[model samples]
Target chain A: MILPSAIALGREFAGARFQIAPVRGLSVQDGLVIGSVLVLIACYLLPLGAVVALSFLVPVPGIGNYWSIFQNATVHAVVGKTLWISSLTVGLTLLLGYITAYALVQAGPVARKLMLAGVLLPLWISVLVRNYAWIALLSPGGIVNSILIRWGWLDQPVSLVRNSFGVVLGMVHYMLPYAILPIYAQMARIDSTLPHLARSLGASPRQAFIRVFLPLSRPGLAAAAFLTSIMSLGFYLTPAMLGGGKTVMVAEFISIQVTETLRWDIATTLSTLLLLVTGALVWRFSHLLELATAKPKT
Target chain B: MSDFTYDTGYMQHLEQSVRRETQGKTVHRRRFLQVLSALGVSIGSLSFLPSARAQQSELVVANWGGDALPAQRDILAAEFVKRYPQIHVAFDTTGPTPGKIKALVESDNVSWDVADRNLLSALELGRQGLLEKVDESIVDINAVPSQFRTEWGVGSYFFSFVITYDAVRFGSTPPRTWKDFWDLQTFKGKRALRNNVEGVLESALLADGVAPDKLYPLNVNRGLDKVRQIKAETIFYSNTSEAQQLLRSGEVSIGSLWSTRAQGVKEDTKGRIDYHFNEGILLIAAWNVLKGAKNVKDAWRWVALSQDPYLQVALLKKLGWGPINPAANKLVPAELQAQNPGSPENIARQIVVDAEWYARNYFEVQNRYLDVLAA
Candidate 1:
């Protein structure tokens, strides 16, 4: 009986050793892919998971934090203000970006290169540096004011920086590149002859351009608006700097809760809400785009 | 559908990008393990290095990081090392936020032996048991002002949120008090206040005619109402630098600013800008030994060294810091007394911020204050 028990133990040990070998049927590429996925999950997904979980857990379990959002008038005002500002920012960015992209596409080689460089140069500079530059240019005694005063543009210096106007200006400046790039990519792919063909078919220049060129750019326009609005919704630094504490956006408000108040529950809850709103906006916009583009060509 | 080759379709593009990224993965196991071991060895050795020096008697001090922080550290370390020559003194210029201090202590890996923190922060952390006792045996409690010293920390220096204005912008009648600061009709142009609820609310209440002594258990509603009156004209500054910039650029004619930052503007503008300490709110920064510090005894000694009247006066003279020790006041030069928050005249007029009140009600008050500001 003792001999049989020893043999059984040896057999179990052999089975355990066999299990330690490389997983069967997994090629090197498959192993690499699995490892990559694991790394991604560990590095990125886990921390995000913690944030979501903490939103529910802190300041007592349940939805007390979320419930308070409705009770507070300030959150309502801030959310309303953020949405309004973002919509304005999207509109301005889309208009400016379309014009800039159109000019870039129409310009000669050297001019096109120069225009593109001008558009992208601001992107290279640090956000803090850019904001500071805006402050220098827009402040009451700044270069722009000084220039305007010297040129007799107005009697008193304009209240440019540290207001809603300043925040939108800073945001539009930051977002122009994001808007322009996608629209430009789509514009570049369009056949340049479509508008000309319409004109040749006895359509007026304006009519041809509106009928052919405008409709063709709808997809790009939608994509640009979607990207700009999403980016605008989460803007913190530019608004904080240029808004000058008056025009408080959602991101800055969330941070104030985290750093100043140390109410992690409120911070995480508001963050989760912002995330949900952003997702809904993207979904709604994508569906709208699908509906618009789904129509057959005339 | 074929015309939908916009960037070759988003999904296909993502797949191609992933393929491009994975194609660069020629990681040999030996090389990978060697790199991993290299990282491990460096990190392991780095951890061991501090412990090895701990055996040799060393103390690490942490403070705010900036261009000026190094100069401040060098001055303090020079004085500290003079008396304690046996123990090596080093400085870490990572600013001590409550979050960072709590993180270090909670993780049971407290690298900071001594840290410069605000009085309220020390009390809050002390209550949480994240900081050691002040070691009163070493740090002479009697020398420090009764209000400044605590069981967990000793005051480093005193500063104030005083009224500063652009001399060019504001005519002869510059705003002198918090009342004048709130008097938007008389004091024209934009006004700036610290974004935080601390000194800001105190200023608001003072402007609202609340007595200095009666400022505790702050009338949050009245203060908020007062702030709201000027909220349209006021642009709140998040930091001292921003406040200084607002004053310097003439974006704001009047600003509620720290004495140090006001002095900075005055010096930067060659006396074109100035500040008055009338109704200034007093704030103190204190030094505390972090809990589970490797060199607690040495940290206590360092804290003790800071209490020396001579060193306090020297710091006052050099850095414009108001000495915490009451004895250091007599030693301060007459010319610097005007800038010193601890001076008899300044202290008489200024309100000492109730640190105990703040430590207890900071979060709840701050949430309401933010709401009020947002509204």
Candidate 2:
């Protein structure tokens, strides 16, 4: 009886398969996919949805919070400063990171290992420690000034830390490792002989680098720029500590609102705006990445 | 092929066992899910459990941590426990910012019984109904000055933002007033100011020739203008420790620093750094009870115990904090009298911060102050 039923069921399954190709029934994999999507909704989207809802509801409902964002001059100044500092940080990080990545690509094995260690070791240290170290080196009576003064380089100690320049410097230091790894990874993938091949073909070394090497490194440069700029936009500690309370960024402004002023509406609104800006940036970068990768390789 | 069995009974047995195994797995999976859901519910509801029951005998005091924690534990907690052995005292070192207090009360989870915060914060939170009123019968309401006392809280201690100057830099003639601090030609050196509105605005006003008695209803524009005059030469410190470092390292010749931190810096530099209470902006730190505190009785008792003249003097000695209880002034040693902010001579020279005015205008003033600093 069992054999007859099994044979009948197999025949029915075979008959159904003949109707549509690749139309398989749900299985364990499908269950897993649905479960993960549900988890994402519950954990990530739900809390974010609450924040967005709060932005509209608090201090009386409607778009009042967003309107305040426009009317408030402090917010405008802070946002403008953040954008300026972030752009400066990105430009400096990319230039310095590209040089380091190029050196890493050209170094021999032992030198490469040592150089890699130099780049990555600071990441292992705490950001607080690193920023404080910068202070110790850059302050008026700090080591840098002491050395300069001893060498008769100046009449008085120059102000180094506690300004936009100091903030950018610390930011560039932090962002270098993040930028270097990606650029290094991309540069390492390029054929080592390509620039040499250009040199062999009667091209000057400078022309070879500009024509052959630089174009190949565009994707990595773009990735590094995108990463550094996004990270810089949200920086709080480096600017707060090194900026001497002058370089107020958006993150610190939001913090002041949340903790000091107790203006949850303003904090949430700024947070939502930051999220949207980050999302837009991610969207724009993805397109750039696509364009970079889509370009024909020389 | 010769050994293979094509028997219907054998095939039927195999199919039956497979069906039984899958059925067992389904039952096991269902049981596991049931247990998981039960755990989730229990864990989620745990927050709603009556915290008061577990904390009946225990009182939690929250304050800004650092040196104050040890000083509080050794002086205030030790003395309180001696008085009531049955009660246990605990501490939450996370500073009780107004934001945290508001959140705790609004969420109906008031974990801290006593919170050490500023008079401005107490006024703000008290008006919002987030703090419990001080029980006049239990607490000695008149121990501190009437201005420092309120229905919602009492002054726990006093600290002032005094002019701290590097004696090594300006040993002959130190800055005694905010006007001298702003005098670049007479006393030319970099200056440090706290990057907050509380003491800063008052100092700026005082420097701009606004009399101490006429300081309230602060001329913010005038104050900002005075601050901008020295803005290029000033480095604003956000934390008290940063102020100490700036002065101690000779980075700034003069700075406005909390009296406690100034004292520490003076000691650290062996009197090379000195601060005078002259023209200081005296600020009060208050002890407030949370609205739904579990150990309200114990909290009141703690506040009352903290006001003991001897204990207040001990706290002053240990932490350089000025005693809130005026009675503690007589108990302070002659050597410490000059250093204490509450000393009659010192208190007369300084102006107490107007908490009522600050509570009303702090939010806007702080924003403007930060804007000026950033600019």
Which candidate has the highest lDDT of all? Answer: 2
Best by DockQ: 2
Which 10 consecutive positions of candidate 1 chain A have the poorest summed lDDT?
A13-22
Ten consecutive residues with minimal summed lDDT in candidate 1 chain B?
Answer: B23-32
Pairs in clash, predicted candidate 1: none
Best by TM-score: 2
lDDT at A242, model 2: 92
| Model 1 deviation from the true structure expressed as Cα RMSD, one decimal place | 12.5
Q: List the residue pairs that clash in candidate 2.
A: none
- The segments of candidate 1 whose C-alpha lies over 4 angstroms from its true place after superposition are A1-39, A108-110, A196-211, A279-298, B1-58, B168-171
Candidate 1, residues A19-53, lDDT tens digits: the string is 32246897556767887897686445544554566
Candidate 2 CAPRI classification by DockQ: acceptable
lDDT of 2 by residue, B1-375 (tens): 233336777765465444323221121222222333544633343221233334378888988888889999999999899999999888877677776776666545566799988788888888879888999889989888798987788998899999999888787888889999999999877899988888888999999899899998888899998999999888888788988998888889999999988998899899999999999999998888999887899999999998899998898898988888878888899998988998889989999999999889888888888888776
* lDDT for predicted candidate 2 compared with the true structure: 0.83
